[model samples]
Target: MTTETSPDEHQQQEIRLALSEIPSRLEALHFVTADARTPATVPNHQGRDEPTSIFNSYSPHLDNITNIALFHNEDQTPMPSPDEIIISQRGRRRFNNGSSPDSGSTPLRMPFQRTPTKVPLSTSMILRSSPRKRLTMGSTPPEPEPTVMPSPTKPRQRLWRQGLPPAKKLRMIEEGGKPIAQLNEETPLSLLLQGMSQQQLIRLIVGDLVAGDAETELRLRTRLPMPDINPMEEELLHAKRQIFRSLPTSRLCKKTDSSAYSRAALHLNEFKRLLTAHTKQLYDSANWDALLDYVTMAWPILRATPHWDSATHNVTRRQCFKLLACHCLAAVKNGGPLLGMVRLQATDKNLRDWARDFDDIQSCQSALSKAISKGRATL
Candidate 1:
C-alpha cells in the first residue's frame, strides 16, 4: 500500500508483513520450554510433576531450534518441507511447458459422442451446431407392411452457453421463449422504493431492512407459539444487512423515471422466495426444530402485510410485512390466515371478532382506491 511500491510490489509487501510474524512465533515457542519451572512449575528429574499427564512437548532445544530454523527460513518465509517444496514446484501443479517432444497444446475445443451415459458434459457437446437434424430410432412392434418409424433425432437438448458468452450467440436472433435479460438491466433495489425521494427511500429501506425479522419475530412470538429471545440477534443482523429498503439513498430512486417502489417490492418478494427455499431445505434435512424457528420468525412477516385491515390499507409497512408472511407460509404448504380469511364467516368461532378484524381489509381497500384516484400511490 505504500506509495513507493507498484501493485505487485505492494502485494509482495503485504505477504512480507505476514511472513515477518513467523520469527516471532518461533521465538515465542522457544521460550515455552526455557521458561518452564521445576517441582510445581518446572518438571522434576524424571518429569514426575507431569508424569501422570502428557501435556509436555519435551523435545530438546537443539532439535526444536533446527525445526524452527528449517521452517522459518532466513527469508522469514516459512520454508516448506522438501517433499512439499517439490510438490509445489514440480508435481501436480506443474503446467505443460508447450515444448515437450511430440506434444502440442490441447485443442481449444474437443468433440465427444454419447453412449447412453449421463456423464456431465459441456452444453456445446450436447447441442452442437449441426445442419443435420438429430433423430433417434423409436422401438415399436413391426407393422404388417414395411414402414419407417419416425426417427426425428431426439430433439437435441437445448444448450445454454456457460462462462463468457460468445459474440456470435448474442448476435443471433431471438426466438419465442422467456425474454433474456440485458446485461445492464436495473436490479430490483434500483427500481422499487428507489422510486421515492432519497430520504423516503432510505426510510423505506430501513423498514424493509427491519421488516423481515421484525415481522417474523412478531409473528413467531405470538401467543399461539413458543417464544425466545435467542433468535432476535439473527433477525437484527438480517434486517441490518438485507432487509433495508430497495433504495436507501440516491436521486435514482425518487426520480419519476425510476422504478423505486416496484424495485423494493420485487426484492421483498424474492426474499420471500428465499425463505420458501430455506424452509424446504430445512424440511428436507429434517431440521424440524430449526424449521419451527424459521416459521416463528416468518409468520409475523405475513400477518404484518395482510390486507385484512384498513390500518394497513394504505401502502402500509404493516401490509408489506403481511404480504411477506403470507408468501412464506403459503410456500411451505402451511396455509395460514392469508389464504383462509375470505372464507371465514358468521358461522366461524368468534365470528364477530373476525368480522371486526376483516373490516381493516375493507378500510385498507377504500384507502387504496382513494390513493389510486388521487395518484398518490401506484397500485
Candidate 2:
C-alpha cells in the first residue's frame, strides 16, 4: 500500500528538484544571451518556453535578475545589458587577435610594437661618437700655444782630458815668507784723519788706544805660561801651611777650654782673611796654577774645621770657601773676574741653597770636591 506524503515533505522534494536544475538553467541562460538575436526565456522541466510572468514574480527587472545570476544574490547592483556585454566581448576578441582561451598563449602583435620610435640622442652620446665643436664669440682670437724652452746641454769633455784633474784646483803649496792676499789694504792714519772734526778725531784716537790695550791684554794672557812658584805665591803658600797646622791642633785642644775656643776663633778669622786675599790676588793675576795649588792645600784644612759640623754656621763658612775657589777658577777659565761684589754675594747664596730642596747636598759637595781634584791634577 502507498503511504500518503505530508505537505512539508512535498515542499522539500520540490526544493531538491529546483536545486538540481539550477546549473542547467544557468547554462541555457548563457547560450541564449551568447547571441543577441536570440530571445531570452526560462525553460520548464519539459524544455518548453514558460511565460516571463513566472520569473518576473522572483525579480521585477531584467537588471535585478542578471545581478542575482552573476553575484548569486549577494550584490544588489545592476549588471550590464546584453548589447554592452556583446560590444565588450567583441573589443576583447579584437585585442587578442582571435587567440584561443585553451591555447595558453598571448597575442603576437603588441600596440607599442606597431612602429619603432626614434629617441633623441643624449649630449654625452653625441660627444662620444663625434668631436665637439667649440662655440666662438665674434672677433675673438684663440689662445696661443705655450712656448717650451730647450734644456741647457753640458759641454762635452775632450778624449785627452777625460782622466785629467779639474781646471780650478785648490793650491796646497804655501808661498815662502810672503804676506797672503788681503781683501782690505791698511789705510794710512793721515788719510784716515783727513775728514775728522776735533771731537771725532779725539774719539777715534781714544777708541784706537782702547782697542790696542784690549788686544795687547789678550795677547799677553794667551802667550804667558802658568807661573810655578812666584815669591808672592810662595809666601801665601807658607802662610796657608802654617794655618793648616795650627787649625787642627787648636780644634782638638779647644774642646773644653773657653780661652782655647776664643783663640781658635781668632785663628779661624785670620785664616779666612788670608784665604780671601790669596784668592783675589790669584784671580786678578790669572794665576791658575798657583790657585790650583792653593785650593788643593786649603780644601783639607777647611774640611777639618770645627764649624764644618755646626748646621747653622757651617753653611756660611762652606759657602765662603766654595765661592772663593769657584770665582778663582771662573776668572782663570772665563777670561775675566766677575764684575761686582753683589754678583759674588749672589754666587755665595746660590752655592749655599742650590739643590737643598731634594736633600742633594752631598752631590753638590762631591762636584765641588771633584773640581778641586781636577784643578790639582791639571797643575
Candidate 3:
C-alpha cells in the first residue's frame, strides 16, 4: 500500500507534468540493421540508419518549448491558427454532398446557381461583363440619352390688345343707388393745381394734360410760370383766407406771405413772372424774398390773334374758344366748393367729360399696368 505524498512531492509531480508540454526537436533513431536475433549485418547487404520526420517541433507534448505562436481554445484543444482553422472548415463544407454510402444515395448538386461577386476582371481590353451588356431597368446604362433641355421662353403677356367680351350689366339699389349730382369742367382749375411737381409745371400745358400723378397737379397750379396770376395786396390776404376756408378748420397751406397781404402779393407777382418768362432755364438772378417788390405782374389780358388757314377760307375762331376754355378752367380753380383737395373734380360729369376730352385719362389708370404687362416700362 502506498501512502499519500507530501505537499513538496506533489508540487514536484506537477512541475514534471508541466515540463512534459515543452516543444522541441526530436532526433529519432531508426535501426537499418537486421534483427539482432538474426545478425548485426548480412554479408552483402549493409544496414543503414534513416530518419523521416512525422513529429518534432510540431509535437503537441513539446508545444511549450518555443510557442512562437501560442494559442488556447476554451476546451484547451490545440489548434494551428485562425486562418488554417477557417480553411479546414471550408474544406469540410465543400466535401459534404448530403448522401450516405449505405443508403445507396446519389450525391445531390443544388439546383439554384450560385453567383460569386467577382473582383473586376483584369484584361488588356477591359470589356464589360455580360450583365453589363444587358439593359436592366435598375442598372444604369453606359451612355444615357442626351438629356434634352427645353428651350427657355419669355413670360407670356396677360392682357390682350383686342379687348375682352362685354360684361353683363349690374342692377342698381334704390336709396343707395340714388345718383349724386355730377360736377363738370366748371369744377375748378385749381383742382388740377394741387399735388403737381415743379418739373411738370416747367413743361408746357400740353405735357400737363397727360393727367399724371397729383404732384403734377399741384406744381401746375402753384408753381406754374404765370407771374400774372399773383393776387393784389388785399387779394393775396383773401386768397390765404380762401385756402384756410378750403381746408377744414385744419390742414391749410402755411402763409408764405412775409408782409401780410401786400408784400405777399408783390412776391407772388414776381414769382409768376420769373416762372413764366424763363421756364426753359433754371432760374434768373434775383432776390426772391426781398419783401414783395413786384418787378412784374400777370395782367389777365385776352387777345385774339389772326392766322390764315391755308385749307379753309373761314378764319377759325380757335383762339376765342381756346381762351374761353382756358378762362373757364381758371374760373373753376378760383370758384370753389374746393372739395377735391386743392382742386380735384371728383364728379361723374367731370370724369366722363375729361375721359372724352383727353381720350387718355381713363387709359392712364390702366396705362401703367399695361406698360408693366407688355415689358414696355420697368416696375
Candidate 4:
C-alpha cells in the first residue's frame, strides 16, 4: 500500500478489472433479454451503476433481436453442437447422392470422351463403294414398246335428239304454223309471237278466243280507254318508277362503293319527300287505304337504304308520326283499337316515342287504356 505503482502497471491493472466486469455485463444482458421486465444493474452513460427495470436499464439491440428470432427453433430447443451439425451435413450429402438426377439434388457429372472404333474394310464393301457403271456406245439398248392410244370416245347423244325437232325447224313451225314440226327446248316466246298479228296478240293477252277470224275477234273484244294523267302526275309517276328501279340496283352496288350508297340515300330522301307530299293529299282526301299502301311500299325502301343524313332521319320520323296518326284516326273511326293498329305498324320503342311525341305520357297512357278497354268491350 505504501509503494507507488508504475504507469504501465496501473494501466494493465485497469484493463484486467474491465475484463473482469465483462462476465457480469453479459450475465445481466442475458437475463434482460430472457425477460424484459427483469431487474438488472447496468452502467449508464455517466459511468454510474443504476438498478432499474431490465427494459428501462438496457434497451435490446436490433441485431441481437434479429439473431435470436432467426436462430431460435419452434420449440425453443438449443442449437445443435458443431460436431452434430457437421455429421448432419455429411448425411444430407449422402442422401442427395441417392436421389434422382432430375430431382436437382446432385450436381451434374462431366461426360466421358468416347473413342470411335475403326471397322475393317472387306471385298464386298470395297465393291459397293466403287462407282456404278453405265451403258456405253457399244451396248445395244432395247427399243420401247409402242403405246396403244385409247379409241376416240363416242360422241354423246343429245337429250333432245330422240323425239324433239331441231331449233331451226321449231322456229320455222312457230313462224309459219307448220303442223308437222313440234317445239324443241330452244324455241323462244319471241319466235312464237313472230307469227301472230297485233290483234291476235291482244286477244291472247286478254285471254279471249283467238280461234275466230282475227279482225272479228279483235272487234268483239271490249277495250277500256286509258285515263288521262296531268303533266305533274305523269312526271311524278315517272320519277317514282325510276326510283323504284334504281333502289334495287343501288342496294346491290352499295356494298362495293360508298358513293353509290350515299346516292341511294339521297334518292331515298327525294322519294320520301314525294311520298310525304302525296300522302298528305291522300290523307286530306280521307284515302286511308291508299296512304297505308304508300307507307307499306316506302317502308321497304327506307329499311333497304340504311345510311340517312340528319335531315332524312328527321323527315322519316315525321313521316312515321303522320302515318301512325292517320292509322290511329282510321282505326278509331272503324271502331278498332289504336293500340292494335300501332302494334301492327311499328315496334314497341317506336310506339313509346310516337306516343310521347304526339301527346304527353299521361294522355298517351290514358288513350292506350281506353283503346284496350274498348277492344275488350267490343269482344
Local distance difference test values of all predictions, in order: 0.42, 0.50, 0.35, 0.48
Candidate 4 weakest ten by summed lDDT: 126-135
**For candidate 1, lDDT tens digit of each residue in 271-333?**
555555556555555443344445445544443432312332234444434443333333223
Selected candidate, larger TM-score, 3 vs 4:
4
**Which scores greater on TM-score, model 1 or model 2?**
2
Model 4 per-residue lDDT at 120: 40
lDDT of 4: 0.48
Residue-wise C-alpha lDDT for candidate 4, range 269-332, written one tens digit per residue: 5755665576566566554444444434443333333433445444554564455455544533
**Quick one: ranking by lDDT, best first?**
2, 4, 1, 3
The C-alpha stretches of model 1 lying farther than 4 A from their native spots are 1-243, 248-259, 301-379
- Residue pairs with colliding backbones in model 4 are none
Worst 10 residues of 1 by lDDT: 107-116
Which segments of candidate 3 are over 4 A away from where they belong?
A: 1-141, 152-154, 160-225, 228-379
The TM-score values for the models, in the order shown, are 0.20, 0.26, 0.16, 0.24
How much is the lDDT of residue 25 in candidate 3? 24
Model 4 compared with the native: what TM-score?
A: 0.24
**TM-score (C-alpha) between model 2 and the true structure:** 0.26
Q: TM-score rank, highest first? A: 2, 4, 1, 3
> Which lDDT tens digits does candidate 2 get at residues 87-183?
5544434544346575445433333222212424243332211112222212234678999988789778675566776677666756653332222
